[model samples]
Target: MDRFELFHLGWDDLWASQLAESSHAGRLGRISRVERGECDVLIEMGRVRAQSDSQRAQSAVAPVTGDWVTVTENDDGESMIEMVLERRTELVRRDPGERETQQPLSANVDVVFLVHGFDRPFRAGKLERFLVLAWNAGATPVVVLTKSDLARSEQRNELPAVVAAVAPGVEVVVSSIESREGLDRIEELLTPHRTGTMLGESGAGKSSLVNALLNTEVQETQEVRRSDAKGRHTTITRDLLVLPGSGILIDTPGIRAVGLWDAQDALENVFSDILDTAADCKFRDCAHDAEPACAVRDAVEDDRIDFRRLERFRAMAAELHESEQRVIERDRSSRSGRSHNGGKRRR
Candidate 1:
């Protein structure tokens, strides 16, 4: 590939300068796939295998697919990834149960498509979690309601408004992957130089939509089971792919649960109307429940805002608050354990 082709893979001067300033002398490459100790990276020359140096580092900073890294040739003429450049945006989620750590799914993405299927269960509360994930990643979130062809006419008409009501400023696309509805509009969003990824539960037709966008079966897809309307893990790993004539797209594995991780501010952004309405509350720190003059409660009573939306907002806010507390406690415990270990060493 030539220098011009590098731009299509999301490389620019900012990345070039970082690689130049680094002590390691090598080519700049974008990681396409990551294994236990090796990864496939795309460089100006071509895709090549490189070893990750993250394990030798003092901290856990392993590279994942979509990361732009500095790769250098070792004495044996093997490629080694030296460092990972700064990411503009990363799609991260809270690791399951009582863990304060986050699992980064994709890096340096411009937009995130939160795919939902009309044929499967549509939970607004679950949608709120995905919205927070997108907002926290610093990427524009677009709600893609897939499987429109299978949806009843009345169901198709009602779902978008309901999704929009919850998503606030986010765009909601109604599509049928089989019939190719809304494919053109989706393609427009995935313009050249922009990177996007899909986050959805199994059976949401994420891979099928990607195939429709690419106009080929680039990713394998399976049908949702008739009994539960659930889909198998079609896309096993989070692999980034270049769209036929557009930007890059990353298809991820199915997500079963969503745990909030330091998304307090994003919650306010997703539920901006509630925050705006709450500003008129009599108390500065109104909880909106049983308060004498809570504007949020008043709005709910007046039917200005749906009560369930407010309730969902409160639930997420509480979840984030608890997550914050847990992180603090975990850090304190780590420090205490370290201090104790140091004292023992001194003896």
Candidate 2:
């Protein structure tokens, strides 16, 4: 029945409604970092380490950074996470090296920063995957071109064009941690009580950007290899940190493999123009490869859609299809196994 400090941690009326209707009784808090079996939760009393095993009773899903949860004490006098509130948005991807598994990177993210370093090559395929991942999470995608200070004249101009091609109607900003250029554009989008996250490969500038915005050494920065420009993973785990008068920012570790997870609708949104042209193909199921009257291929040939753009679109679509097939196969096999075991699943 007492008041709680929820404004600084991205709480709003919607969350309050959920809290009022929640079946648990404890102090409301937001998860800052998740560890082995416990997590650091920021509560009305401040940050406290709480046992998270209590979460499994109410929700089957494990806790992640940026989750709003309730804390209570058990008979042993240890802080415990009672329950986790429903999430608004989640940045998800197919688990690395797993066919039909999903890895939730961050929860309740309002904005997703597609951070890429201008110092390295802008791999269109990799960046497009990031776009699809962000879009599928229903977050506002912003292309943040970091390390602009090291980029040459041509590199600076060329990178934005590629971003525009892959992500239409999305905002793009060129930024540098040293010069502090274009940081304001990214800051204006971080309104109070909102949540955003920075996602990119390790060698990219995600950690450096987080340190700059937070004005502290919240995350460590490492140098990339001179030969390959591959950076080490400085951020081992994801954590939700608060900004001064701004919203919360989730800094995640470098993601190497970005496979899709239920992103078919998002793929269409990203490449609607190309799919629209495919409507005129000779066959309804036309693959657009050497097919007669293929409007999609014609669009590429006539310079309507960039060649690489079309290629990335097709590649992502294929990946989604393969993911669907794997899910089906896994489910069928699971059903068969259960049937053989007399309707009981095996260990």
Model 1 Cα shift for residue 322 (angstroms): 1.2
The sequence of per-residue lDDT tens digits that candidate 1 reaches over residues 193-223 is 7888999998798888878877889889998
Off by over 4 Å in 1: 1-4
Candidate 2 residues 1-347, lDDT tens each?
A: 22236787888899999889979888889998998968888887778888887536653567789888988888888898888898899888898867689988778989999899887777877877888889899898899999899999998888898788777898999999999998777777888667889889998988888788888887888999898789888888898888776778898898876889999998988888888998999899988888889999898889998888888888889989998998999999999887889845553
Ten-residue region with minimum lDDT total, candidate 2: 53-62
Model 1 deviation from native, Cα RMSD in Å: 2.1
Clash totals for all models, in order?
A: 0, 0
Residue pair clashes in candidate 1: none
RMSD of each: 2.1, 3.0
lDDT score for residue 210 of model 2: 78
